[model samples]
Target: MQDRAEETRRAVLQAAAHLFFERGYAATSINDISERSGRTSGAIYFHYTNKEQLALAVVEAHFAAWPALVAHHEAALEPTLRKLVRLSFAVARAFRDDVLVRAGARLWAERRSIAVEMPPPFVDWIATVERMLTQARVEGDLAPHAEPSRDAPTLVAAFFGLHTLSDALDDRVLIEDRLADLWLLLLPGLQSCPAPRALLAEVGAAPRARRAAPTP
Candidate 1:
């Protein structure tokens, strides 16, 4: 019974995240979340006090999942360059499917320090990106000049820019198809030298985490 309840709660968070991504924080009402998740508002209230709380929890999950997301594109231990390129493609794919992520990008945009006050999930995403960029730099895949600590905001902006363009471009759905072309161009400006294996070794040597397999 406890497990079932926990499952329901997780479902609510995911549904809320999806809704939050599609609708702005103020615009996404509790009713919208309830309806989308196939649960009663009462049930939602059981897990979350209000839309704001739900939004925070939902964003929290997105941040926490960053490691898992980054791990997927790496199939080998010697292709950090390709991994970086693939990461770009993955970002494009995520923005395409996740409406909440799209909305959050706009809402929590790095315009000012004001964005720092966004829901937990938004803050988490920013931090996670900073961490990933830091890792990229350490692996020598990122240019020596790329300052993850001071310029993470810019890196996030570049990623979001790609997402925004992919959406606005009439040929956006096919964006990943031409990802290689863009990656090649980006490669020169970003990396001082190729260091694909460093990334693979890091990802591969890292402790493996066990997760519940997705339900059918």
Candidate 2:
């Protein structure tokens, strides 16, 4: 019974995430979630109580996913700067591909409409970037002028702005390419050392090979 209940809850959350991604908070209803989940209204109410609570759950789940992503990279032996760059790419991929992340982003953008207080967006992200930048500085990889305290928020804002623009223009299919462009432009200003060619290639920012000199 417990396992079945857990399964039902997962189903409901997945359904809610899809609806929220497709339709903003005000447009999505408990009935819509029920229809999508194929679970009765009473069953949803038994678990979620109301649309507001369900929205909050979906948003919370979205935030919950980040730590594991960070942990996975942290376990890898890499420079802090490289980890930060790769982490941004990983998050961009999630924004492009994960329904829950899309729902959470939309819900966050539309949080004012939701009656219940939702967790503030971007604060944790900024903090994470700041920590990574500070570590990069300690590792002597950050440019001398780069101040983590000042730069972290800027980096986070640009990263999300790229996603927002990509989503608006092309439903985020171009997000990874946009991110690569951003890094190619910003790396020189942020790093004291040249970013590894492998790292640049990983995010698709690698420079093109020079054309062979024309035979005389």
Candidate 3:
């Protein structure tokens, strides 16, 4: 029974995430989630009290996924800066491919409409980047004039902005290219390494041909 209940809950969260991503908070409804999950309204209500609670669950689960991603790269045997670059690519891919991530991004953007307080976004991410930058500086990968405390927030903001623009422009199909552009422009200033391009290539951050526009 416990396993079945867990299955039901997962199904409901997955359904809610899809709706929340496709339709903003105000537009998404409990019935919509029920329909998507193919579970009865009562079943969904049994797992989540209301739409607000369900939304919170989806966002919380989304936030929960980051630590594991960070850990994966942290365990890797690579330069701190390389790990940082790889982490950004991983996040961009998540934003592009993960329904939960998409839902969380939209929910975060529309937080004002949510009656319950939502978890704050970007605080932990900024701190993570700062830690990586600090370690990179110690490892002699960071440029002499760079300060992790100051640069971390700016880098995080730029990353967030890049995804936002990609979402608005083409649903993030060009996100990797944009990230490559961003690194190409900033790496020289941020890294002490003699070859930023080589570093980007090592991490597979090279830009690719843009996807053709959809036929009207």
Candidate 4:
């Protein structure tokens, strides 16, 4: 019974996530989830009390699987700056690849209630990358900073800049390709500087001369 219940829950989340991604959360109804999951509306309610609750479940799954995604992008690297860049691309790719995740994020943001205890997964994702930037700074991979740790926010800002800018182009692959250049633009004035070989190999590989576009 537990196994069946668990399977049903997973199915519901997967379906809801897809709908939320494609349709946007406010547009996604429980009826939509029901049809997508091949389960009845009662089954969905049986598993999750409401669509809001179901959205949370989808986010939980995204967070729980996050470490593995990080590992996949970073695994082959020898802890170089490129690996970090690859991880950034990996994250963007993950979000981009799964419309459900995108829709779910949209839904959550729309339904955003102060009453909910869940910290935004997007915020948490930024925090995780900030930790990485903090560590890299400590190791002298970034530019000099009075407080290298404080520079974590910059890392998040840079990624957001890249994501928003790249996404606007509608060709995220191109943005992923130019991540190294993006890092260079953002890394200046930081406390530690990563080695050029590492940076070039991992973070600075764009051959096309990029013209600066206005930040969104």
C-alpha TM-scores of all predictions? 0.61, 0.91, 0.95, 0.74
Candidate 3 residue lDDT tens string, 76-106 = 9999999999999999999999999999888
Q: Write the per-residue lDDT of candidate 1 for residues 54-154, one digit (tens) a residue.
A: 76565555445456767775544654544655566566666666655554454455314222345433344456556766766767667877676665565
lDDT of 3 at 124: 98
Q: In every candidate, how many clashes are there? A: 6, 0, 0, 13
Q: State which candidate, 1 or 4, has the greater TM-score.
A: 4
Task: Encode model 4's per-residue lDDT on 1-216: one tens digit a residue.
Answer: 999999998888888888876776678889988999999999999988887788777766666667787666546645534566667766777767765556555555665541344545456656666666666655656555534346556677777667667766874667655566665565454425434434545444544555899899
lDDT at residue 90 of model 1 (Cα atoms):
65
**Over the full model, what C-alpha lDDT does candidate 4 score relative to the true structure?**
0.66
Residue ranges of candidate 4 with Cα displaced over 4 Å: 71-77, 113-118, 121-123, 168-173, 178-180, 187-200, 203-216
* Candidates 2 and 3, the one with greater lDDT: 3
Pairs in steric clash, model 3: none
Best of the two (1, 3) by lDDT: 3
Q: How close is candidate 1 to the true structure, as a TM-score?
A: 0.61
What lDDT does candidate 2 reach at residue 150?
Answer: 98
What's the true lDDT of residue 197 in model 3?
Answer: 81
Q: List the residue pairs that clash in candidate 1.
A: 21-99, 21-100, 22-100, 59-121, 60-121, 80-196
Off-target runs (Cα >4 Å) in candidate 2 are: 196-198, 202-216
